[model samples]
Target: MKKQVLSYWLKDSQKKTYPRLEKNLNVDILIVGGGITGILCAYQLAKQNKYRIALVEKNRLYHSTTGFTTGKVTVQHDDIYHQLIKNKGETIARAYYQANSEAVQGLKKIVEEENIDCDWVDTKAILYAFSEEEAKRLQREQNAYDTLGIPYEWLDKETLPFQTLGGLAIPDQGVFHIVRFLDGILNNLNVDIYEKTKIIKTNPTEKGAVAETADHYKISAKHIVLATHYPIYKRFNFYFTKIKPTCSYVAIAHEFAIKPENAYINLIDPVLSIRFLDSADPKLMVAGFGHDVKNYYSYLDQIHKLKAMATERLGAKDFTEEWYNQDYESMDMVPLIGKITDAPLYLATGFRKWGITSAFVASLIIKDLIEGINNQYAYLYDPNRNKNTFKTVCYNFAMLSTVIKTKLLTVPKSIKINPGNGRIIQHKGSKIGLYIDQNGKTYSVKPICTHLGCTLRFNNVTKTYECPCHGSRFNYDGTSLDGPAVRNLTQL
Candidate 1:
């Protein structure tokens, strides 16, 4: 099987590189991530013309989760209304819907005003159920819509290529080429951007905060925003424990048999999402089958399952591209966006696999907070709020079990690892990560994660070592792929 390639949105886009920071610089605001959250935040702040802004990215902009997404921009997040209303209240649930809906509308206005061609489509979003239990849950979600006065349609069956017990359809929801939209905003904004500039540390001074890059260049800013998908600092927020990172798979197929009119996701376990790249063509995108990163024994199995589902269930043929996305799910189900406990540092993360709309919403809240303007949705997404301690406790327990299991487990010495594959083996009283390419060349590295020292697992599909503790990933050659880990693994 062929390895994953770039997403359809990024295939034809021109790559724009920015200079790295050569010396220490001072700015009004310094953003540490170049994803949608950081880009939008910089745009909103730059439009006001009040502060000097600088944004830094570890890699190229939009090459992370923002570009790897399924490109669905909607408020219908898999029968979420029912759960929100039950957990928080009708008032907060309505606010959550309003926040995301307004984000969609805001994006539409931006695309129109800026004259961007990101294939923006005002399509419907549908959530289907495969079993009676899921159908009942969807019915409760419909009731939530009623409570919130939101318009929706309940369907027993539709024109979908697959069978479903029932479904929920919400109109005026949409999808767009997120990379194009972000690129347009970046082009129009006057913010200083630096790519391939990884930040290693950020500490608060008396007046502000200082961010130090891996190259030892410093950026002093009055305010700092950690828009990195996973916050680098774990001590202040304990985000490593509270936020659960999951690995999800996606595949794009050409010559698909059925064209979907709207974005579709199911309400059952191992959720499957479907949508078309173009309403006029047979190009289709299917994504889902998420699991906690630590629980995955073989990444290839997940990719194979997604491809099988696309071909067998959705009649997809000749997959053109496939990729994986990692996202952190907040314990409370609401995104954490706001000040990090009265410090100058701010954060936007834990979007629960719904970062597109949440990123926009976070930008708005962060902008308002920095400008001393009151936002109505601020309290709902407060990072310091500990209303869901039960979930946090349960998550900590589960994490401890995984950590202990990784430290104590042993692999049989007789088991032979295959060529072009990786395995963790006990060697000389320590665990060693070993990978052999198809040509029979050996590549070895220390298997421990550089982030929090969690044991790393071998991902056969990506040919990388993944951390179960905090989702840090490393290449076979010990180079860092994702973080929470600023340093690469130590070569054995």
Candidate 2:
């Protein structure tokens, strides 16, 4: 069998192209980033028949987390309601529940209204636990559901091959081809889209704001939304301190005997989330064994355990596709949406691997905020909510520890790097990241993050240099692949 190290969704789909921004333009609303949040924000705003909106993406659509997501359209995000209620207030937690639930309906309604050809499948979203401790936690979450008036059913049994204590089930959840759904929306959206247009920086003006592209083209708008998953702006909102980024992996198994009627994720560490694709080709997708982005290739072997799990439980015989994706989560788990520091500039992020409904929720909130309408969930998802300062301080301290450890360890070490492999070495008192390709071509780059000067770690599997502090990633040739790091590594 053939093997692909790309997302099965990306590997199997047709890509749509948009023109890059070549000159300065002015619009009423300028949306930065083209992930689901940005696209959906544009979609919602366009529906009002107001605002001259232009959506700019650094790369083509579906080339980011929007394409690599697990693609489940459910409101169940692990077992988060209980935590939300505890950390945030009941009002915020309840609002989050209602927003996400409504988002699911909104997505389904769009599919029905547009008669989109995306493979939509309705299924129960279930959460199973193997330990008694986890089962008790599920009961507590069930209590939270009761308090919030959310409907759920008790799951006394599990269909999986492993022994489970008990689980909870939420009905009316669904799954679909996320890319196809977006494509369907894009076909009808009356918005200008520019791919490969990187907005390097944004400056505040008295009237509104102006965003400068990497090519020195400016887009002046009354409002600019930084829907980039990780806020590319380094210092403005200070999101880097609260947000945590991770590198997660997924594998698809074909011809699997186990077919589930619902989406399932366990209450366990190194979480195991399972879903299916039912269409011309039926397959099982197992995801969620990840580490901090800084760990990179060090913890990549965890995905192998997830594969062995599918092989054991589902009788998965053919594993053809495996890939890695990045996710950003807030320390408090609730997503961040709305204006950045009360400016016309906005952001929606910290989806925590549940971007489907969260993105819709963001679009709704952002649209309302822009229209000057008070959305019920607006304050709950606001990016400006003042919370614990200790969490921020602790996060930054850990970041500082990473910096110290990296710099102290970067002494001169003579090493022989083989072809098809890479290593960091001290060259004239400066750390240099070196990667040798299969053909013996060498690629050299400064081993430092452009965002915060953090030491960059190399991922052998994905062939990218990743930053732990802010989750910036670069390709082997020193090209920026992901952000909070908008700048590429320096060639050395």
Candidate 3:
């Protein structure tokens, strides 16, 4: 209830809670984080009658990124097929499409078997180009699609409501109430799930692994899965350096009239992704472009701009709900899945905005690993792959440069802030942060990020402090609201 943004999907849903792990427990498999991947992984492993799987969440289940999504269950991730071919390889790119395409149908089978009422639909997914340059990019993407034998329909300028160039649409895609879909699956699971159970540390053991909670409770398991968006373990995989945290916003309009219903995305920086809802509460959802978390902006401005775009182009009515979600993106623009450590520990992160397919694929692959079976797609998503791409080196160097650049910045001797406002000010020989609430109450904390010591930035619209480097978030009172920062800002 204290959240700054209310997602359209979560607005009318009843909050579900699971018991917390209060004492040390042992299980055949320990799953940390209760997002879709973790829940689905538990569902798969639990139903297999193999591992005595138990899932734990640091906070409420399904309240994080999973709750705030465009809910498009499709294999089309921008023109990633073409990009992946250029960066990774043709084989990897083909595997990427093949794996996700299978996951899409795999999800359909689950929904049908369980008869889950998540407003499932088999619609079309579109990728539009906004400029001539983007059209050329789309052409290349089409070539890649040909190589992969992925069928698609091409669109001209007149086919769309408003567009600069053309687009491509893939049939057999879907849209659903993802939160409801996840809830439907979770409510029927036989496995034990614990909420508000934060795992702060994990150690590889002779037998398996031991994960310790912030409260010092432990869960010893024969295997552990880090399905959290960004694995909290900083030592292994160098996730903080390899995975770049990006955030994006979304706005919903309950009244809309659009033709040829399909999930759409445009080729633009911070692409504007749009999807429609034909359910009882018919609406249109438009997501603002994603930007690196380190790049701070006026969050309110983003919402305003998104609404304006929807109103002008899509003929959207009054907006009902809007929120933001942060997703991790690896340097190579591919998800990092499977075992990252020598121990029987697996992680799936850097999903970008296409978590639906990625999450399902993750569950399938992790299940295969648990069963000691070889999954062909495992090599494509391997987290330990040599990611020394030019982009990776450049990105990590830029992040480190940000640390050095911020550390040397000169601070003012004194500063003043208005009520209900937050600002970084020089305090006690160090630049700290201070927030003055509307009630004229003051809250102060150190501005250094606990995850990597990067300087923190204030998101005025959300009234929370965020790390520019890795997306750690804290309340004005200095309690950590997001991770991979388990520790809150030091209260000053």
Candidate 4:
């Protein structure tokens, strides 16, 4: 039997591909990503018809992070309120909760008004604990919720398949089919959409910015939005240093015996998120086991661990679909959603795996910033907010350490690399990435990241060269897959 590699969401829904940019055209705003954040921003701006809006996507719409998400639309982000209250303040913490809660309500209103049947379901979001330490953290989160005047329920017993010490439940949180929801909005909007349109670079003009595509087509717009998962431009913002990329695995199993009443996440080390999709046949999606992308020895091993957990603990006979998702977490924990250093180029990223609500919040903030409307939550997610120097210093140190390790590590001299496998080895006094196909054809490239010159490591499961410094990924043939890295690895 063939392995299921795509997400259940993508498998069940019909995906619409758009035309690529064949000619250079000017627009008032040019959004450079087609994920939920970019699409929603385009939808909001295009609905007004005040300006000509164009969205350009490097790949299919919603095929990236948005499509791979577990589709939980909740504000409860893994015992975050307690830390927010402690680190930032009660006011900021309350504002964070309020922003996300408002985003949920806003999305709900849109679904209802538009009659979007994206399997929208309103349910409580529960954060449970398995250990005493986690339980205490949950208590602190509950206290923070109370101080913020947010309504929640403290539960000792729940309908979850497994046992938990206790949990905090925030009502009215939601889960939905992300692609379908975005499709509903996209269908109703008038924005010019382009797919397979890779923006190679963006140059700031006196009036606005000019985005140059890989095909040499130039799009001049009054404003630009870098809604790509990772900001392609690195010089101005230094998002590569600020945001740390982590990859998580998810598996979906059909006919789950024990379905919880609400969306669930745990407070354990390897956090597990649970949600159910009620379509023609019910399916349970389990997501967790996140780690730094470079730290994993093998992506297949990580997937095996996730699969074992699901099969043993959740009574899943087998997974109908399985895939991995990547997310960037900011050093300060808050998402960076605003202008990139007073430039007309705006950015929205570092959602830390909780992008469903963060993306909506980002769309609102970016829309307001562009239209000169005052959004109160803008300050909380500013890209150039006051730096937590200690955290920033630590993050930079870690990145530097990874770079040093990658550069200094000795490569194997005469290792036999098997087919369907990849490795970095020393060749001609320099590191080279080598991969052999099942048919015994060999491909090699310089094992250096195109983003920042960090040494690249081979990801055995995905068969890609991944950067340890900033999570840029490249195909075995040296084509760029994900960024921070815009350029492909140098072919040897």
- Candidate with top lDDT is 4
Q: Clashes in candidate 3: how many?
A: 2
Q: In model 1, how large is the Cα lDDT of residue 314?
A: 74
lDDT of each: 0.84, 0.83, 0.84, 0.85
lDDT of 3 by residue, 1-492 (tens): 232368777764557778888999999999998888898899889889866888999888877778888889999998899998887788989999999999899898888988888888898898888777888989999999998899999988798777458789899999988877888898789888999888988888999999998889999999999987778765654677788888888988866657537788987775678888756667788997678876656688777887787777778777877788788888887889998657889999889888989999999899999889999999888998765777778888888877776677666667778998888877768888889999999999998888878888777667888887778888888877676888879998
Which pairs in model 3 have colliding backbones? Answer: 270-289, 294-468
lDDT (Cα) of model 3: 0.84
Candidate 2 ranges beyond 4 A from true positions: 158-162, 296-300, 410-420, 438-440
Instruction: Report clashes for each candidate as comma-separated counts.
Output: 0, 0, 2, 0
TM-score for candidate 1: 0.94
Show model 1 residue runs off by greater than 4 Å.
Answer: 1-5, 158-161, 411-421, 435-443
**Segments of candidate 4 deviating more than 4 angstroms:** 158-160, 413-420, 436-442
Stronger candidate by TM-score (2 vs 3): 2
Listed in order, each prediction's TM-score against the native is 0.94, 0.95, 0.94, 0.94
lDDT of 2 by residue, 1-492 (tens): 797777767764558789999999999999998889999999999999978999999977868888898899988988899988998868878888988999999999999998988889988898888677788888888999998888998877654444577778899999898888888898999999999998888877888899999999999999998888987654465777788887678888886776545788887765678888866678888887777765534545776887887777667778888888888888888888888774678889899888999999999889998898989988888787755567877877888877776566653465888888887778876789999999999999998988778888777777888787778888888888777778889998
**Tens-place lDDT digits, model 4, residues 1-492:** 356778877876566779999999899999999988898899778767799999999878888788899888989988888899999999999999999999999989889998888999999999988788988888888899889998998888564457778788899999999878888897788989999999999978889989999999999999999999998764574777788899899888774667645888887766777888875677788889888875745677777888777777677655777888789989878999998764689999999999989999999999999998999999999988756578878878777778888888788975899899888988777788899999999999998887779888887776778887788888898988776988878887
Clashing pairs in 4: none
Clashing pairs in 1: none
- Ranked by lDDT, the better of candidates 1 and 2 is 1
lDDT of 1 by residue, 1-492 (tens): 354555777774557789987889899999989988899889888989989999999878878778888889999988888899899998999999999999889888888999988888888898888778888888898899999998888776765557778688899988887888888887788999998898988888888889999899999999999999888764464678778888788888875666567889987666789888865565788898888887844656787888887787777778878888799988888999998875788899989889989999999999999998999999999988874599898988888888887787685443477788888888877889998889888888998887778888887767888888878888887888775787888987
Clashing pairs in 2: none
